[model samples]
Target: MKKEFRSGCPISSTLDVIGDKWSLLIIRDMLIKHKKTFKEISDSDESIAPSILSARLKLLESYKLISKIKIPKNKKENIYLLTEKGIRLTPIIIEFSLWGDTNMREFNKIKDVKGLNLDKSYIIQSVQDHYNSMLLNF
Candidate 1:
């Protein structure tokens, strides 16, 4: 089923492409931790069902947000990685995590989001600056 979005805002449009509960988390797993295998992502706390994980990975690939590359030693297995577009979303995810940290008490235990002690804007800028530095070095 196609997800219905609230509006045509650019952010909303982007979210429409990936706003589902699972997609962002999958992307987050890749962007932050570099998780890159079907098995690794399937084992996340979301504990996504294999069918759903397969479907979501296909959708993300069709949209060009991620690419599945063959693992060097074993060409049979694929490693998922973010495209430039996918890496660019790190700030938005960081911002959402910051908001959740301050306002949504239940999710603090989530990995990587903790220990930063970062404020909303700080995290956003930090992600942006991190991406910027990456671009410079690349």
Candidate 2:
């Protein structure tokens, strides 16, 4: 069940759901790196602990930001995919990336990622396109 917040403020409500560093980082991995599996996500540069990863995954899934799918041929493994609500976070992610790139010296390391053009409109369109394609396949 979704947790109740102190008030109905949008920012506070958003924070209540995904305010933690790990949660957003997990979302970043999925949004930017396209990681879908536990192993893949755990291998991110942040190196989150397995226990913490599991908890955060549960929280994200509970909020309907992501969905866990059992791998057809590998029952022991599950893949995660973003829902429409999650896809809507692309702009915020891009804005954060831009902020990091502008303020931090090491932020440019991943700036050259293919299809991740610095153009805001392009990034938004790319995210929407990817989401639409995934829906079609589903």
Whole-model Cα lDDT per candidate?
Answer: 0.77, 0.83
lDDT of 1: 0.77
Runs of candidate 2 with Cα error greater than 4 angstroms are 106-117, 131-138
Model 1 stretches astray by more than 4 angstroms: 1-9, 106-112, 119-138
TM-score per prediction, in order, is: 0.75, 0.84
Candidate 2 all-Cα RMSD: 2.6
Cα deviation of 80 in candidate 2 (Å)?
0.9
TM-score, cand. 2 vs. native: 0.84
Clash pairs, model 1 backbone = none
Clashes of each: 0, 0
RMSD of each: 4.1, 2.6
Judging by TM-score against the true structure, name the best candidate: 2
Worst 10 residues of 1 by lDDT: 107-116
